[model samples]
Target: MAVEKLFESENFLIVNKPFDMYINSDDENEKNTVTYHVASPDSHLSSSLFPLHFVQRLDYATSGVLCIAKNKSSAARAGKLFEKRLTMKYYLAVVRGHVAFEVADIEFNVGVDPTTADSSHRMSALTTSEASERCLQSRHAHTRALRLETGYYDNRPVSVLLLKPVTGRRHQLRVHCSAVGHTILGDYTYSGTRDSMPHRMFLHATRLVLPLPEEPLDIQTAEPFFSDPKFSSKWRSDTAYYKYRNKEDFKGVCDILNKSYVIGVQYKMYKM
Candidate 1:
């Protein structure tokens, strides 16, 4: 229930939401959620900020920068940015394997999982051709993954990746990562029984960039659990990793979208 207010403006309220908490719940009796915490009468924020309109959502297991519009006007403006795919979102994750590509531009059409049970939620990543043949409801999803570090977690090879989602589809990052054969750790929904049992999912929404008129907002949160001894260790300190980590030059182009996405990963992380 502890949500840290990161930045607040007249039109927006940015907060670092914790993991394992719902953004909101259908059951009014559920007081353990982000909405309740921010809107509660006793909240530290002003009462005028009541009934905060969430501009976006974070999965129950995901934690990081979340934007809340203080009013409907602001919400509408931000909503348009999201719909137009103008917002930039970055996430950090510890996955189950050493990723083959140091830098990759991944494109997959994500659709409802045909294999998942009716009660659970799952998404499947398919090639453009495969999606048309099997998944009528599939939507285009794209993500750029940059491997920051590779190490062992509990004797198993794991990779820490900085992910940028070009298109915001439900579970796009998770589905794309899993499709690459390196499911994010503790992602039981995608990793299933083979994944480890971390205290929470190893995925976090680390940064968000919104191109709002006049003044753009770029907010970021520090690494939540990447350095914990329980999660990773014995990291490889190759000079190449440092080169990319230090400079801002890892780039890639997507043939599917015919667009180039160049991102600089800045992380001072090493585990011994």
Candidate 2:
């Protein structure tokens, strides 16, 4: 188990996740799971029995930082925050199209797709525009995607974006980015015609803010996978992924919270 620990506390520990890893794959696939990769020998989830509880589920095709609860009590509390839509999740991505809109809140129904089992997840469901409005009003997971830069690739523009998801849906960031005409780079499920990456989707779960007991937990961390240039160079140019190289933004946010998360696994990843 080679898990890279980002930050550890009595309540939770954040780790950098490997690409192509499921947060919680079934036992048959545990060897390829993020839990199996976790380096810490903290006896599963809590009482030396269950596996650690994963509060947030980053898409299997997506890779980045993840929060894991070491104990059952903390796990329950953190899970509630996520379920109640109190925790804020952010992702940095390169979408396929340049978004003209600076910001927009998307409302849609997403469920299992009866079609291709080739895809691991279900796509969007059929819902009326009014019903979509109600979905937004009730769930209140507002995803704001900010366009950073755009470039032409084969006569198409790929937009670098910062996504802030106010609520956590199964694949909210991917779907929301897709719905807005800018599906994430390397996204297979939401691709328009025929374009994808050899690796998982190009969305990184760069930061998380969870409400804590004292002053409300505010922990910001990045996937070590993003810190390296070679890993990014596999598909896109440096201009698209350079923001992640300088982790000053994460440190700044950590300072605001007066909390710092330490890196557990600083693996010297080779470029694939």
Candidate 3:
């Protein structure tokens, strides 16, 4: 799979990560990971910056903007930004059920099961008592949602959500959305077979805001799965729910999102 470069500089690189590929895999034989592709000899990057480092991670099934550092020093600098929670990560997800509020925050205690391993190790929301018992290890996760639109998919209620994760835990948005009875579409682990699922996970990491020493880097990726005709066709044919009839309308949507969330930052949009 070809990785699409969004932005590139001497110190930093941002790419549109494809769905179903790991940002970095533990196994050396897994050649399809982002790290592998970026380090390939045929890649545009210089061999001097061989081991490009990922500042953050997106799940294998999720697609969107990913930040890569050109060198170790740059990676360390970017890591500090993430540690201080100075980076604002935004996601766009298609979920089952109509989310009523325009803006809302979901807070929960998320922990991974110690018994499971590999992809089977699923994260779960712990009850208050459970969280208290394991306070030392468990993490407090918070996700904020801005409802973009509420529409119907195959006569079933579906909503487009713009999610900002205040705290980045594993699967924080997915677990929070599911806890609220509107699991993300195609998230079989959380949503179960409650409603019809999309062909792939409906969550996309739409944007990232990183505050560097010089300036803030705001990067965004064009909606890959969100605007797919296969998914949109499922919406009610009579309504304009999921329709982007032309390029102008699509650009309008992008402008609205940029204006609403990413203010006063040098922003760039990348293709996938």
Candidate 4:
């Protein structure tokens, strides 16, 4: 349960949180959470940044850039950015089928599924008719997906997507992806037992931007699975079969994203 420290300053600390680890757990038996490692006496972060205050949360099965505030004042400032929906979050994911659209916006309402026995823990997208018929607890979720590559995973068709969640709701990305018939690979709850299980979920939070005072805090983590020795053998990029409908538009989008990596201000051009 080691956390990679990505950035540290007087007010904030950003870390690459490993997948399959909880941020916090009510179960006393659990010791693999991010909070446990950060508070451990043996950890380097214990003395300087104890009593951790997380600005946002990543799912237990998702990994990447996670932000933590060093103190209360910084926490309040960072919290405002999130509350105002001024922060940007980007994620990388591999899904079950070839994504038809090169770029499309997925908007739907996500809520607890009363139809299933696991309603308490499982979520589903409520269709317009369904939403109007029932008074289920739900929220409007919006996400923009950019298909990066179409490929084969363990001989089954899959697509690599860069996801931008415009509105943060519980399991927004997962629910939206599934609603459009491309449930993320290795997402057991959404895809069910039909798809082959990978070592871990194929979703990773690749980048985060926090707009603070004089300068914005931007942090990025490399896409983990693409180069992973364990995952490479099973992944095959299919450049021949799939082609973008609008090649220039796709290329332009990629260029903007790449430029944003180096010139931080360039990200605003693509931000929705």
Off by more than 4 A, model 2: 39-50, 114-120, 125-141, 152-156, 222-245, 250-272
TM-score leaderboard ranking = 4, 1, 3, 2
lDDT by residue for model 1 (1-272), tens = 59998899899899999988988766668877887777763232334346677888888888888999888899899999999989988777878877766567777778777666363377777754635544447777778777766777666778877788878888888888887788888887888756646777888887788999865998877667745565435344332342222112222211211234344533221111
Candidate lDDT values, in order: 0.71, 0.59, 0.71, 0.73
Runs off by more than 4 Å, candidate 1: 41-49, 115-120, 128-136, 227-240, 243-272
The most accurate candidate by lDDT is: 4
Q: List, residue by residue over 1-272, the lDDT tens digit for candidate 2.
A: 35577788767778877666766544544576676666333335344454577777777777777888877788888888887777776667777765664444455455444454356454542244544432332232346554444655434567766677766666777766765567877788777445654345678877777876753665555544335564345434323322333467544432322322234422121111
- lDDT (tens digit, per residue) of candidate 3 on 1-272: 88888899999999989877877755657777787777753232343336677779888888899998888888888999999898888787888887666556577777774544345446766545645443234577877666667778778888887777878888778877876778888887776555444677888887788889774698877766546898877865322333333434544444444354354433322111
Query: In candidate 3, how many Å is residue 106 off?
Result: 0.9
- Clashes per prediction? 0, 5, 0, 0
What overall lDDT, based on C-alpha atoms, would model 1 receive against the true structure? 0.71
**Error of model 3, residue 258, in angstroms:** 12
Error of 3 at 152 (Å): 1.9
Model 4 poorest ten-residue lDDT run: 263-272
lDDT score, candidate 4, position 105: 67
lDDT of 4: 0.73
TM-score for all models, in order of appearance: 0.80, 0.72, 0.78, 0.81
Clashing pairs in 2: 3-39, 5-264, 6-262, 212-216, 212-217
Better of 3 and 4 by lDDT: 4
